[model samples]
Target chain A: MNTERLTEPSKDELASGLRRLGAMDPGPDFAARVMGRIGTAAPLPAPKRRMARVIGWLMEPRTIRVSPLGSLAAAACLLLALGLFLKINPGAESGRTPAGLSPVTFVLAAPSAREVAVIGSFNGWKAAGWTMRNDPATGLWTLTTALPPGSHEYVFLVDGTTPVTDAAAALNVDDGFGSRNSVLLVKNGDGTAL
Target chain B: MDKPDNDRDDAMAVERTLSGEREAFAVLVRRYQGPVYRLMLRFSRDEHEACEMAQDAFVRAYERLASYDQRRRFFTWLYTLALNLARDRARRVAREPLYRQDLDMTLADPGRDPLASLEAARLLDALRDLSPKYAEALALRYIEDMPLDAVAETLGVSMSGAKMRVHRALHMLRELYGKEGKQ
Candidate 1:
């Protein structure tokens, strides 16, 4: 531990310095000023609507809090998480998606590619009909598919040859090979845009 | 992540918060707001910006509550968020670096009303002259009387790093005091 040598200032000197530093007062109504901002700040209008607010509130990080109920919820969540983690194949395994359904669109900017397939937790990482075609004139590859509504990790197999990742998505999971696969977490029964 | 009783308390709080118990969060805000505000004030030169950043940090923390690791102290996480926001604000304003300073009067005027106590005002001014990092370290370590490990966690630095910051800050403070004494 890098403890500082507490300089032995004369008592009078130290007391005077301490008194000087201690005078800066907390602003009156400091707490009120802080609390006033609770729900008033106008978020991006488009994302401030009722549904978005609800989704954001539910998925919001601060809601988890550091309180008694929060701890219980956290414990339950941890247990649930542990259960889910343990139930899943813990070993080196092929991509096996859980049972559910979520609609996802895979986009690739490979104008030069003839094909692109998605392989991830959704379809056992298989290269099949998941390959998408470029709208040759537009130079962008696009494929929309129904994935189970949950956290599904996926990536594009460009030209059925090169595996490419999504740049625009928010969540991503590492794909063991020093690369990452884009993750789309579709909340259960919510068609909200991430 | 302390004892079972504490864990129970945390869990109960978590449940209330998740159940949309607004006051539960308020309880948390009231509890940790002072530390968070002070930390921000150390980072941002102005009280208004510090208040704004601290508020933003709380809002952001509230939004990210579900991801809160229950084992950790809420204040530590909130401090990290507040510090990050202050850093972001600093970057946007193209402010001086954290540990480097021009020793300007950027701090003498914290707001309209000056501190009522003369001695405290001098100390506050001296503190303000230090770099944000050093000032924050000193405030957290000395003013707040936080333990070394807690200070480290709040500052998001290793224990050794936190100690170094505090050490350097105090050394500078002593120097500033020496200059004042000479004067």
Candidate 2:
């Protein structure tokens, strides 16, 4: 391989060489194979417009005809039955871990913050239920909760107003608003990150 | 035909396909299949994988047709999708040993000099050593013979950015080839 002398090839030579490299034939049946695969695959579902969804919801028939005393009695019975069920299944009442959910600790260090919450695709970007607790000693807010094993994009809300990304996150994606959101990849029960 | 005419034809095809004529997409497939396959082949260096990726790219284009902006050229959009797919495939097969296709066998001219063929192969090998962005920029510019503006459009960069990428890529290629020569 005596390619030493040919190291500094002219620009035209490089262009011609690249042109040669890119000239492979893709064979005759290429289009046919692609069309065949398309025929076998399922067609994409029609996208529903917002107006259609609203119309569908509005058109759905509902019946509500109950006496006030009967409604109150039914509500009371439902509450008593829920209390009995909770008494029997204490773990369910205590919010026991669902199957296939791995515990992931979300930490944000905001010393001066009054409140901090983690919001992401997993929780519909809701800050109400996924609030973090602050540690007086380290001033680091932490929340350890079970998230389904997958990649999740999250942002930390400081004091219920400011949105901040976790600096410790390994991956980040644009939030489409000139800001970035951190990404967390939770491994499965077998310790495999997907 | 002129470039604008080609772009108009592509836009018309997209309009027809979006209007429920699925066969209109075939027009697009036929028009771009060669260049898309060539781009994928440059990335994977495997004929079979390139074909699969090209087909997959067309299928994806059809599926995501609604998302396609009519203002852009169809081939540029399609080429970008194919490039991303090829990059993903390359990443998955990164650990596998690379099998370089023999460039000499596919030449149309039998009387071509063997030494030139060897040199071409060495240049391609040096190209493979460059980063994907740089190599892709160079390939789209030189191999596909795309204009700087088209290259910029395909790469989602400004014309000046595309020019810078090509310059940097060529510089890297020169360094790589020079080092290989010394070895």
Candidate 3:
């Protein structure tokens, strides 16, 4: 057997030799050729229509949905229906009131000289027949109107148009856009009056 | 080795390509095509097959550029893909006895002195006689002048493993040369 020590080649000798053996210069126009092929190759088709179809299917009814706007609209309609029912049916138990029945009563207090009336969500907030005469001796104005034992709001009319709130009213609600309304929550059949 | 300067350059080129300069991608294709093609040739053992595999690897790399973890070595990833394709080709070759006659010296150098070309061819033939893994290790080590670690990365193995493969290949080559001397 031939026995000889193997010696390592210098870096320069190794590099130039490998270069000559085709380790470098991949070929002329290699990059341009590759990029040209890539550019000219047919592109993958997009799935926009398929995606839109999927979205449409998902958005269809009977699928899961959390519609805040629809829920809000339903809530508003429910509230409107409730308000209408409450207006038409003030006292749920009794509908007939004697012309002079006067069993239902409404009042508003004005310490100064003025006139008062019962006006509410029930009677469209008018003060026609239910006006109170001011007693000059006591300087207090009081009105009593036969309301059908349900919730209503009333206030004092200082000459004709100026409406004053009743300080002693048991119920008051803020009118939200920055005004105040006196609310009277009257539960009928409990023998309560306001 | 050079503080990943070439890799940084590759990433910049990739970025430029994605930013609508398709020409930038060509620069990358040009730069790495040699290594990638050589690696594929070692695997396929045929120029045409190697060229096809290399092209496939590059196209695949371009398509999946977005998924490439730029923090890692790009060639390693590309070579892995090319090697896998070559392995598939090898498996197919093993299954089917489809062989082409080895390129003759006459064809390799039609005009050059036949004796010198024959010596270079002899060295290549000796290298090819080694097991595929060992031959690849030797080729990448001496022929390509790649670092042991980079060769391992390309071959998808550990450094010590690649080092051992190269060491074993050299021992085999010496033994073969010794045998030739005795004859």
Candidate 4:
């Protein structure tokens, strides 16, 4: 650390001098030049209607109808059909993965951690809604979540602040912000990782 | 207009500009052109480049006007945009030598007091030597005479972080100025 000497200007003097340094005259034509360019330049495009606003409006319920028994029956049939389909056509089940999604299990041994979450390109780098559950006895935190297939970079956020990369991951990439993120290649369920 | 009216007027200009009144943007440009150009000059250290960068900043602000949060001070957003532009320009021109012997010849006015000019030049040189973060904080807090909260908003830092940067920058500047005086 560089220490200030007694001979140096006091902070107040420096501040006052800086303030008095004043704005440089950008010339008499500055504003006119700016206005001219703005006049000639293309106008801003109108903003696109946001999908989130539409979704929010759609999510508001106007009414509710109860059909518990019928809904339960339909749900049971759907589950049975899904199970049979998975059993009979394992390859098809994997191929049918929704929009390149695949199940992945992330495990971390953190004895001191109270809470952990996963953040990555898959979740738009957000730390919410992807929390991991911890086993108190083994002191192991685990998260099983579906991620889009292909190379996805992620980090384990510990206690909502510390970003820890997985040591077990053989692949890692620089996040371009002075941090490394663990890279995971989700397979297409064809026994080959992308 | 008084200070509060001027601020409210700036916001009103933004609203008008966004509502297809293209001429209203000129009001904002005129209002802020001085500080914006000066801020750029602090980073670029060249008057022409500063002018161009200030123009670029205003153009960008106009293009991204819809994203501006009206609750915040308009200059904060504009200053932040100009600083980012300056940083990008600095990075792109990092390989090139910034200081030129002829700079004084081109910039200095013969009629002006030589002593004041020399002092200003020395001050600018010292500022250039400081870290970019420190330079930016000092420029915003002192040169622009922004309130601490406004400085924090412009730099995307906390109020305390802004304060620390200003304090550290002043200390660094003092030390650098002293060393220069010795020579």
Candidate 5:
């Protein structure tokens, strides 16, 4: 593929220059600006969806990790994961909350909108009993309710008919109606909120 | 993202952010501004566009934090999300013009990158000529210093696929550099 041989920069040199791009920095106020958009002392918590501390325990480069540990250790890790999953996610497949409902909180930060409601698979996509409570001081709308441990899809219905996507959702799926709905997994945890 | 020791700290910060700690989320933003900003630069027409796109990516990631698979690294997830936003931006904004222009512009405007070596500049110029996917593969592999597995995970490709892309990318970059010999 070489029409003319070039020896200015070898592969290693080219690779080195490319890697230097990784060190480019942004403006000093970058973080503050981001916070300004999210708010510093707002009235409500960031959003309803959050914190998989256990999940973030694994970082990017760790994907290639291979330990010389025996298969027994692997099995133990698997068993621990399964136990943790079952413990953290009781309402996973059953879609029922026999161990009692988990408190699931959802927040929508819509200041301009006059009304907001949450409609999802749990409520059959209806907002009848899911009208959200708004705080004028912060203009953040919040809704905390108990749901059986399981997966759920929802959206914030701003005003009355316009559906808005939850930017804070753990997962968002196609709504099949030219829009997207946020997804959340409610685990069978303690008195803590999901 | 590569720092194993930071994993626990990242987890803690992420947990705080998820728990509605806005300030905690700022820690992540401040921490990752460098690589994230650099990543967005490839997809933008200029630094301003890159900055806007990078910020948008973070806000979107914050919005979709719940959707993130915990098994993956936060930076990986954030990088993937930023790439998606860049793609979406490409469709809507219709930008990412020729890379040679960027080279010329940066050289002419010494304030932009006064320290850029000619060799380094030419290499970057050729890189931008490759297709987005190929460039992305090379960037992830060499620039980001990601393992093949991490590159595969970021690109959503199998390990073999990642290897193939990298191979092809290097060949293509070599051809482009050869053409530069005429200049």
Candidate 6:
């Protein structure tokens, strides 16, 4: 029972009993029964004769909504693919990495930033020797780091001051500074697992 | 448990179900069956009909998943859809619901007070006879234990409108109940 209620029902047995009635369950196997007959009838929008149309709409392709961040991420993936095509490995991607390391690429769309650095647990959280290159052609900041197969925490330092976490990160945690830090898991022998 | 959390999970389920994962729709059916079934019982106290109506509601929702507005709470949209189905079924099928029989069976317990059950039954009878709008307001507010904003959302009305409907319904129910007392 919630002690701090936002609204009060009538203070009477009828209302109280009605509240108690809310506990009633629909009974077991209810979900199983519903699932057994979902596809029997066509939707009101689609008549039976238009089965091919339904299949066409169901199989329709969708496009990504382009945004600044989205464009930067796409550019990063393209750049990574190109790097792989040419077998290009920017050496010393990060300060320290274990044996059998993979180069991981990170990107941020900070067009106005004068400088950007990659700071994370990988390089002792310091913004030294981990500077990301700025692509003036696209205004996207990017860095490729070679790391072994393991989990890592990282954040982008825009203009060497403010920290920005990747919005598309699979997981993130509180940075204890009223902000978030992104987590990245490097897959098997893949460089720039952005 | 929180509204935002439920909304996020439901949005994901809706997305997955839309993207050819038929099993994701089952997760939604399992999550909301109890509430949908209870609401159906308000329209027809028969357990079998309530279950059927609930199943129909989920199927209809699955068919219309594309039309669901992401702005509204998924449960609110589902409850409103179920309510509309119940109303549509009532109009199509002319049959009196077995309210008293189901109530007796529900309230029959060894340690339960017989008098309390009788009063509950009488109140439910008045509830059934009440106008559909008022009856629905009471059911959503009390039986569903929904907050005022959620009740408003489910009823497709404003906050004051929900409050007015609930209070008026309560007043009508009390008068009808007093008549039951006299009899």
Best by lDDT: 4
Q: Please identify which of the two predictions, 3 or 5, would achieve the higher TM-score against the true structure.
A: 5
User: For model 3, how does the per-residue alpha-carbon lDDT over A1-194 read when each residue is reduced to its tens digit?
Assistant: 12243333333433343335453234576666566668754323233567888998888889556599988998999999988886666543345554533344444445664566656576677777767756676666655434455566655556667766767777776756465567665555544555
Candidates sorted on TM-score, descending: 4, 2, 6, 5, 3, 1
Candidate 1 Cα errors over 4 Å, as ranges:
A1-28, A40-194, B1-14, B94-116, B156-161, B180-183
Number of the candidate with higher TM-score, 3 or 4: 4
Candidate 5 per-residue lDDT, tens place, B72-170, comes to: 778878888888888888789866554665655542444556556455556666776788899899988887777899799878899999999998988
Q: Predictions ranked by DockQ, top down? A: 4, 2, 6, 5, 3, 1
Instruction: Write model 6 residue lDDT over A75-122, tens digit each, in one string.
Output: 999999977855654544344456698767788888888999989988
Whole-model lDDT, model 5: 0.75
lDDT of 4: 0.79
Tens-place lDDT per residue, model 4, B58-145, is 8889888888878888987887788788888889886233454534642476766666656666677778788889988998888888
Instruction: Mark the regions of model 3 whose C-alpha exceeds 4 Å error after superposition.
Output: A1-26, A41-194, B1-3, B95-101, B105-113, B174-183
Deviation from native of the Cα of residue B30 in model 5, angstroms:
2.6
True contacts kept of each: 0.13, 0.44, 0.21, 0.51, 0.43, 0.47
Point to the candidate with the largest TM-score.
4
lDDT by residue for model 1 (B76-131), tens = 66676777887787778754432213223323445534433333444555676788
Task: Give the Cα-based TM-score of candidate 3 against the true structure.
Answer: 0.49
The CA-based lDDT of model 1 is what? 0.65
Colliding pairs, model 5: A91-A149, A167-B63, A168-B63, A170-B66, A170-B67, A171-B67
Q: What is model 6's interface RMSD?
A: 5.0
Q: Chain B TM-score of model 6, please?
A: 0.85
Model 2 regions more than 4 Å off: A1-6, A40-194, B95-118, B181-183
